[model samples]
Target: MPTFLKPIAPWLVILFPILTLPLKFFLKRIKKTREILALIVPVITTLFVSSYYSLIVNGEVLTNTVFKMNNILNIYFRVDAASFLFAIVSSTLWIFTIIYSFGYMKEYQNKDRYYSFLILALSVTMGVAFSGNLLTFYMFYELLTLITYPLVIHVQTEEAMDAGKQYLTYSLSGGALILLGIMFVAFLNEGVVLNFIPGGLISKSLLETGRSLEITLLVFLAGFSVKAAVMPLHRWLPAAMVAPTPISALFHAVAVVNSGVFGIIRIVYFVFGPEIVISLWTGKLFLVLILITIVLASIIAFFKDNLKRRLAYSTVSQLGYISLGAFLLNLEGLSGGILHLFNHALIKITLFFCSGVIYIVTHKKKISEMAGIGKKMPWTMGAFAIASLGMVGIPPSVGFNSKWYLMLGSFNQGSLLIMGLLILSAMLNAGYFLPIVVSAFFKEPITDFEEHQGFFEAPVSMLAPTVILAIATIGFGIWYHFPSLVVEVVVQNIF
Candidate 1:
């Protein structure tokens, strides 16, 4: 890439997908053309993002300013190690999701609208990842909520519509809180541009003296927590499970929830910095709440009979680990938290993919209905079993490595309670996930599935991604150093 052209990288990545919106519309009647466009856009976007990997790994920050409305509001894009990590993970996994969608959505209605919003959501998520300032991030973040709303209600049933309304209510309320925090930041800093800095934009002297700093932290946490699915703000998630499984798998699992977690990260590490957060009481309170969410959500997950709803609650619990890691304010905790963002995305998506395949093949959604499904859909259930173990933090799976670092972080803090909560959460994780696996593989077939025979599985398109991500759950666990390298760069920059 040319030195000057490097600045255009982010714009190109964003624009490529947006440009396809019209192409998709033009080719609406041509189903083959639309499918090819949908598939190729993500692949090209991922390639473009990867081309910049060498630059990011070599410690270069690519920044572009579109324009400035004033000192306080500007349109800016930046790609550093942190943003690059998010972009690469989302874009890379998106390829698999798109491929999986081909198989899963083949019979579904509204193909054009689904693929259109789906592609548009990718652009918006990239915007969130590359945003260089609070204002920039907030704008893109709001856009993400709107773009994905249609997907949430794609089925258009009364239940789906209700979920969409609830999603909007929570998301808009969270966005409002974030906007208020931005105003506080601007007023405190005398209208300085709210650009994200490595250490923090807020001065330590101000942090120590300003009581409002604590309030500001609270507002930001509350805002991002709604989307991160932190407790009291998490009801929207379980309700939204009525969405089609691919939408649930990608938007709910990877893009939307991760964006919320990513925002909280920016607030703690980039906007406020660890030093400032560590000195505030709000940080400890937030940490305590995150621990509560981790354990409580897992307990709820154990009792849900519906598989997607169970996974929805599981997502709520797992997301707390990331937030917990970020708020710990220790290097080990931050690294673990950041790394889990990618690791958990891989594991959760695999689970969701497997669930979609199970529903398609056997029309089974409840855990009780899945007995001996392992015999009929061996490949699907095997991948599900692998992902389940990963979710439980078993060894040689990626989930274990991130959880290990989290425990180290808790130990570094010398807080036995935090460590205990994590251990308890893991046990709870096994309580819910292992039983399903055991019933599928070890128990006798239920009457409904007794007629199923051996070696049947989903289409290659759907089964391939599930198996690949399951393999990656262990593969990346063994080669943990690769992702850790990116995370170390991120931690170095922030600390």
Candidate 2:
């Protein structure tokens, strides 16, 4: 992409989140047109942004200075391989999400505010992906958490309100930690131009002094960990499950939480040089924590009975795998982890989207209530089955490939026990996901479902976006090799 167009791609990332503000006012005059307008803007922006970066993928880092405000504040952006990868993921999947939300939110009032935050949330996410400095990234990251709060509490009930408060509290605390990390980084890099350079700008003395490197890494990890839903920091996620399905779909799938995982990768590889991080005890400790998170979250998932809550816990377990790969401190682990970012994202989103549709059509939240739902919403629930199988790391889906490479990386680590934990987690994965498929398809329908031949699924808007995502999940699984190529390129060129 030409450097000029490169700047525009970052703009597209925030197109949704940014527009939401004005959209709220526009609805005073434009009212219901907001939905059609919502569909048009994000879709157009996604296409425009993707094409711009696709042009420059050959061997160039597209950079643009959006503003040179001052020494303290600057408008800096760039489209690198990493930025291109994440921006496209959000902008594209968000297009489908908006479509799904249209029918999903049709009956709800106050949609003006609803779609408004949806747009703003997306826009800031783009900002997070394309940010050029610690300062800029922190700004956008906070914006994402703040803007999505309305969506989290869209239902306006006592439970929804409580969930929103907890979400805000946790997310804002994360923002504070991130801000502290940014100050330390800026304090270290006082006069240098900022870029996603390998190894941070901090001096060696600071890194070695008083376990500073370990402490700094922990601050960033604790900051980013809240959203990534790492163990002990993940209570907010299941609590936030009280929101409507679309909100859950958007936030958990790729918007709110993905930003956290994305931030960890960006900080690890871009902020602290991978080599420096690996040489320190802090990095090794984080790796051990992620491995423990993977095993433990999977075990917890096995015991949850609420549909969204089970999936909520499943999200925690999957994120552990992503963290494990990122913290492994090698190419296989990094590549596997990065690829899992996309793989787990698509599959997990599909699972949540389908779950949302099931509740909308059936008024059911527990897995047991979904018995025989397969007969009602075959296409909808069928995708759920396929996605569940994929979650269990079954073949012919994208999740299988992620698990395969993750295990390969574990084996590469020469730890026979980590390899065992990998297998055990998959079995635990099956323990939660498999039963849902079995309950919906193999078992008799719940009594309420027996007479409901009149309906098979949620609205076309809801079911269509979900099934499409399910298809993308399977398709993206097999396409894992393509990202492997990109990861090889990142290593060869950047490292």
Which lDDT tens digits does candidate 1 get at residues 66-138? 8888988789888998888898899888889989999999888998889889899999989999999999999
Most accurate candidate by TM-score: 1
Write down the lDDT of every candidate, Cα atoms only: 0.90, 0.77
- Total colliding residue pairs, candidate 1: 0
| Cα lDDT of model 2 by residue, 7-50, tens digit | 35465455545654565465667656788777776776676566
For model 2, what is the error of residue 438's alpha carbon versus the real structure, in angstroms, after optimal superposition? 1.2
Which residue ranges in model 2 land beyond 4 Å of their true spot? Answer: 1-9, 12-32, 69-72, 203-206, 450-456, 480-482
Provide the clash count, candidate 2.
Answer: 8
Among all candidates shown, the one with the greatest lDDT: 1
